[model samples]
Target: MTKPAEAQALPDPSGGDHKGHRERLRRRFRDAPGALPDYELLEMLLGIAIPQRDVKPLAKALIRRFGSFADVVTAEVEDLRAVDGIGDVAATALKVVREAAIRLARAPILNTVVISNWDTLLDYCRTAMATLPMEQFRLLFLDRKNALIADEVQQTGTVDHTPLYPREVVRRALALHASAVIMVHNHPSGDPKPSKADIDMTRVVRDALAAVDIQLYDHVVVGRKGHASFKAMGLL
Candidate 1:
């Protein structure tokens, strides 16, 4: 009697089918052309977050909603949830990616002298702060030579405003022994243009610090569009 055709066609149970597929993907990723497209990179990342499902559609949806890789990673959790197939798990995954990017961006400013890397410093500050839906006031404390000592979030407020106290800023600088400082905040409105109040508040902080012999290096306004430096603009 002849054996059944279906049984004859089946592969041996010991064959490494599961491992082979993953190795093929790994090889393709390593050998792929310049810049392994966003989807592929995202696919690899999502494979960690969602082990059992196809993540292409979700990744594509995120890109479509947020416009680019950076924007998607930086998007607010609520905005991320608005996309189809994005739930708590996906939102959390995107947030983890964003947090990693922020930490990477700030690495240069952490131990090294920040004054020398002004661009990276601003990029770090902006990337780290601009994702918030509400306003935030942050201070980057620096030593006498302008090396970063600590980065602190002083206050968080509503979508439009954050209460800032010049006296408190000065006091904190004194306590930290920070000879110089950089002030940074974000506007949820996506315009980096500094408002009159922003300028006024910056002057208040600057003057207060100046009285205590602490330099106010810059007041950086971060928004989705970009960042503006008050000192560079001659506003300080």
Candidate 2:
């Protein structure tokens, strides 16, 4: 007697398959490197952490929770874990991406004259501080040749404000023998518009640095979307 042939089940064409979806995304990225939407880029990243799993929903959920793909990368570890399906390894992977980006942005500024590299300076600043949950006031001290001397975070405060002292800012510059200084701070509210306090603080810091004969080059306010430069606005 001839054995009956076992019936083969076909994949449902209307339903999506993880392998096919991921391969399609990978092929799309390879074909046009810059064309994938932010969610797809994030999906590819998540796929690395989650093996053989459908990561598209997790990727979209992360973006929806954090408000953007960049925010998802830059989110705090606990915050990342709070999202469903994101475990320790996945959260750490996202943080690794954030650090890599910041390091890449910072590479050009090292041992280089910063005044001539304004764009790179801004890029580094944005990568480091733009997505922070709270306010941070950081200082960039420069040498006589305008090379970066040191970068320091002087204060961290609430979402709306960071405490800063002009005397301390100059004192550190003098201690570092920095000839010029650039002040940088981030607003958690995603608006780089400087408040009145920002203007007054810049003036005070400028005067204090002047007393020490150190130049105050600019005060920059950074936010998630953009940055504001005091010198560019004629406020310096």
Candidate 3:
């Protein structure tokens, strides 16, 4: 009689048995998502972009380098790519997550009376501007009822300075038929405190808007550390 053929071992489909760990993570997330630490959540996110390998170490490394899960997702694509295991695909994935978060934060304030939702407005502004690597000046145009008409970036400049033209701001406000405006900008240095220049610029913009009967609601400066509001400080 011929000897029975030996059975061959099949290859594992979960990329070296990582599927079990991933499944456990999924179950954990499903059961109690809030219980999972930032690194665990980040590991799961990275796993979706990078398959066929253990990604726990990579996730931990990213959290370490970026300081937190929020920082990791908000980091620039080029900066994300600088990490050892991150490629274009992974960087794009992170950016997509960031965009989703920003849009979600922004949704509640749109077409709503901004002063009534001041905290939400600040949350949205911080989500959109806090992580930027350069200065970006934005205008929040408001209708007669103080509802948001449009949110537009007026200028982007180097890490510290962005040129602002009061005339351009007035022009945009008039074009949008906005009766009020809120200014916003970011400080890459992670300090939300406005410099003398910021105060002077806000004064100029306020005077110009007043000329056209447009109210200056506030000038908000966002940074990684926190945010500041001109109105809150009695500067507006």
Candidate 4:
């Protein structure tokens, strides 16, 4: 009697059969989550989206293409699909995970005094904006107690610059009944240092807000390198 076709197949170079390997990965994740490196963690994630196949090579390809686990998830879907085994389903899975993480980070700061939870707010900002491909100007509107009232992306621009209208910012603040606001934008160039243009635009917004008696709390610039706070640097 001939052996079953699956039994005749050669072992996967990564290890045993695909199903067995996937179970081992899950067991490792459940037993000691931190033990798995980026590639292994990503391997497991990809398995969920592409069952019936060994995903180790695909996972490593993603890491090599994007440089890290975070970068892979934050990558544009079309870019993700360009990888060898990543399809619409796999790319969407990665994006879903990224969105879940951003929402998790953002939950703590909603309706809370943001300055009191400063670190969490920074974390939320980085998760939302750090990996974006272009510049995005965002506003955090605050009530009298400094509790966050709204978070809005005011404009999105090219890889290097965003045109921000000070009058429009103030108009939105007044309409929202916001007592104060935090300005935020990202640098795709990975340096959070404020450009001369960034500083001048910030000053223009500050003055416009002042006319409406709405305080400008800070202007934070975020990037892959880190974040810079205008208030902390005495630029505000």
Candidate 5:
């Protein structure tokens, strides 16, 4: 057995508290000469929520599980929960960060000239809708010369389908007095390839729009893999 004097020689558990431990790491990150790497940044962010623990292991676990920072942010809630330390709070926090980034990207498109700012429109669409687990069909209404009038979600449906009504589309376009419109939807399977139904539906919308002298500018399909543009693909 150990001696009575040796029993009191154990290291004190409260020698350094949470704040001191975290401050040390923060100082290390701040003092690094060059820019901190992506993983290091992630570590800092994770530290905000999970204070008291060494976040490097958790950070590595997340990167390993999701493959990349974007993948981690875009991961489904269930997928994020599968990680050891990731709880509902952490997952939601990460999702909010992703959404904030998307909102920032979309700010330039909100009131700008839609024709010249097509890139921003694409960025907003990809960020807002592409990461969804189900399909959502949306419309971007524009007036003459392609100035955006409204952005609306027309329908939400299963992974493979949505109920799109050309009459409703026309009615909304007329209400907004939009001269042209762009159609957008997501493919949950991450394949943006247009199906036969997609092609047929576009034709129906085009014909319907013609009745009221509105134009179908293009159809854009967003997916996790990439995006497909009907105009670029010669399908418009």
Candidate 6:
């Protein structure tokens, strides 16, 4: 019974049609999955975390600010919040995605034969540490069955160096009854090539573990761009 002018004054119920837009994007993803550009991928994810908002611009802004999709998700929550539109929910969602990815990468290798499952191990190392701003040395302890018992980050240091203790490394393996170990460290410089110190330290750790009859399977150096293997390079 409202007049035409009164009807015009009432707000539109349909609003901006962002719901339909979101649905279209989701359909496109379901049909062609991974076909979207990285920005679109982030946009779709952000839409879920922040309903009713136009998230495309924010997604593009995040990628532009952080340099890539991986970097954006892996960014610290506080830093992500500093961006103009990202709030607690958005920041936590991105971080949850990154952590879930890291855990998924680890799943295929945990308690499995690391020697044969080498690729998954590298994936985990890359996910967990390759992009780190500093050096962190981690160890994968394996039992006689070649199943992983523990993964531990033993040291973290400046951009170029991480102090290692050969005796301590062996002692921990012995305590854990681990029969073998794989050492991993990241080069924030993005080159996986080992230094003279890296080679010397690997040898020292190998010899020390050999005394306890524990195997030094490998020392892996991961960088932002690639990874190196001591075994493949004949250094182990």
Give lDDT tens digits, candidate 4, residues 1-236.
Answer: 44322211324455448788889899999999999999999999888877766888889999999988988998888788777667777888899989999899999999999999999999999999998887999999999999999999999999999999998999999999999999999998899999999999999999999998999999999999999999999998
- Where is model 3 more than 4 Å wrong at Cα? 1-15
Q: Which regions of candidate 5 fall more than 4 Å away from where they truly are?
A: 1-39, 158-163
lDDT, candidate 5, 24-108, per-residue tens: 7688887982466656667777777665556666778888887767667877888877776677666777788788987787788
- List the candidates' TM-scores in order: 0.77, 0.84, 0.87, 0.89, 0.73, 0.83
Candidate 1's C-alpha runs over 4 A off are 1-28, 32-40, 78-84, 130-133
Pitting candidate 2 against candidate 3, the one with the higher TM-score is 3
lDDT of 1: 0.80
Candidate 6 per-residue lDDT over residues 39-64, each given as its tens digit: 99998988888775777778899999
Model 3 scores worst on lDDT over the 10 consecutive residues at: 2-11
Number of the top candidate by lDDT?
4
Model 3 Cα shift for residue 98 (angstroms): 0.8
lDDT of 5: 0.81
State residue 91's C-alpha deviation in candidate 4, in Å: 1.1
Native-to-model Cα distance after best TM-score fit, residue 62 in candidate 1, in Å: 2.4
RMSD of 4: 6.0
The predicted structure with the larger TM-score, 4 or 6, is 4
Q: Roughly what TM-score does model 2 have, to 2 decimal places?
A: 0.84
- Tens-digit lDDT track for model 2 on 1-236? 43212101222343647878889899999999789888899999888877557788778998899888788887778888777678777787889999899889989998899999999999899999999888999999999999997988999998898999987898799899999999999998999999999999899899999988999999999997799999999998
Model 5 reaches what TM-score against the true structure? 0.73
Clash count per candidate: 0, 0, 0, 0, 0, 0
Clashes of 1: 0
lDDT of 3: 0.88
Quote model 4's TM-score.
0.89
